[model samples]
Target: MRRDNVSADTELEYNLRFFTQFIINPARTGAILPSSDKLCEFMTDLAGLGDVSTVIELGSGTGVITEKIMRKKAGSTTFFALEINPAFVDATKRKCPDAVVYQSSAENVMKHLEMHGESGCDRVISSLPWSTFNGETQQLILDSIYDVLKPGGVFLTYAYVLGVVAPASWRFKKKLYAKFDKVETSKIVWSNIPPAFIYICEKASR
Candidate 1:
C-alpha cells in the first residue's frame, strides 16, 4: 500500500509495531516510532533546512525521514541516518541509497562521525522517544548530539504530549535553556492522531 493511501493513525501504529517487535522492546527501550513521512516533513520544516549542508538523524526507522530529507535537496547536503536496528538500517539504505546509513545508537553517533573524519554536523534531528528512556541514557544521547553539532547548528525532535507537552520535560527544558541560546516549539500537528509537538533548538553563539 502507498503511504498516501494509509491513514496517519494506521501508519503510526504499523511503524510503532515494527519498532517494538524488531528494533527495541517497547516496554524496556521506550522507543516509540513515528511514521516516516510525518517525522520527515516535521523535521525538515522545523529545521529550516534550506541552508543546512549536512544533517544527522537519530533512530531513522525504515528510512522515512531520510527520504524526506532527500526531497529537500539543498545543494549537495549529505544526510547521515543512524538506526540501531539492523533490519531498519537495511531498509533505510534501500530507500535512501544516497544517505550514509549507520547501524548504531544515538549515543555513538559522534564516534561514528569521528571515525569518518567529520568534525561536526549542521543539524541533528531525532525521533527517539525521550519519555521512555532512562535519565542516564537520555542525557548520554543529548550530550552526544551536543558534542557533534556545529556551532549555531540546530537540533529538532518530536514528542507525544503526556502530562505536560509545552516544555516536554523539566530535564530537557533545563538542558535546552542552559546549552542552547534559542528553543522554539511548533503547534501540535492534530493531523497526527494522538498528536505530537516539535521542538527546535539552536546552539548558542560563541
Candidate 2:
C-alpha cells in the first residue's frame, strides 16, 4: 500500500539520519537508531495521553515517538517537542508536519511552556539519553522537568536494557527515586533493538 511504503521509507530515512547524528555527537544523540514502534506505543500508553491536557516531549529524535504521541494525545491536548539536534528537529518536523517541534535543549522546556501561557504541563514524556549526561547536566534537566510539571503530573522516559548496569544509569535512577513521589518501571520491550523499559515517575500532588 502507499501508506505502508511511506512508513517504510520514513523508517529508512530516520535510521540514516539518526545514525549520522549519533556519529556526530554520541553523547547527545545517544542511540544509533530511533526508537521502534513497540517502544513508542509502550511509552505513549504509559503516559496516559488521552487524559493529559498540556504535554511536552524531550529529545524527540526523528519524531517516531512524536508521531505516536500525536496520534494518542487528546484532541484538545497542547503538545510540543524539544530536540537539540537540528537535523533531528528537521526530520521530526518533516515526519510530523503539524507538530510543534522546537530545536532547543531539554533544559529550556520552561520557556516553551511560558510561550504557551502555561505554568506547568500535565505530562512530560522524554526520550533523552540519560546515561550520556554528566551529573550536572542530568540534574539541570531533571530539575527543569520537576519545576515545569504540574503537581501530580507524570514524567515518562526509558532506559536501555544494556545500559541498566552502567553507573550513570544507576545515578539517574537514584535521582528519579529521590525527585518523584513514585517511580515505576515497565516491562522490557524485547522487540526493540538493545531492548528498553519505561520509567513512570509521578510528582506529589499539592
Question: lDDT for model 2, on a 0 to 1 scale?
Answer: 0.91
Error of 2 at 156 (Å): 0.3
RMSD of 1: 3.9
Encode model 1's per-residue lDDT on 113-190: one tens digit a residue: 787678888899887767666667778888888888888888888766552444336666566567667888888776
- Listed per model in order, the count of residue pairs whose N, CA or C atoms clash below 3 Å is 0, 0
lDDT of each: 0.72, 0.91
- Per-model TM-score, in order, reads 0.81, 0.96
Q: Which pairs clash in the backbone of model 2?
A: none
Q: Which regions of candidate 2 are displaced past 4 Å?
A: 1-5
lDDT of 2 by residue, 89-140 (tens): 9998988898998999999999999998889999999989999999999999
Residue 54 accuracy (lDDT) in model 2: 98
Candidate 1 overall Cα lDDT vs. reference?
Answer: 0.72
lDDT of 2 at 97: 91
* Candidate 1 colliding pairs, count: 0
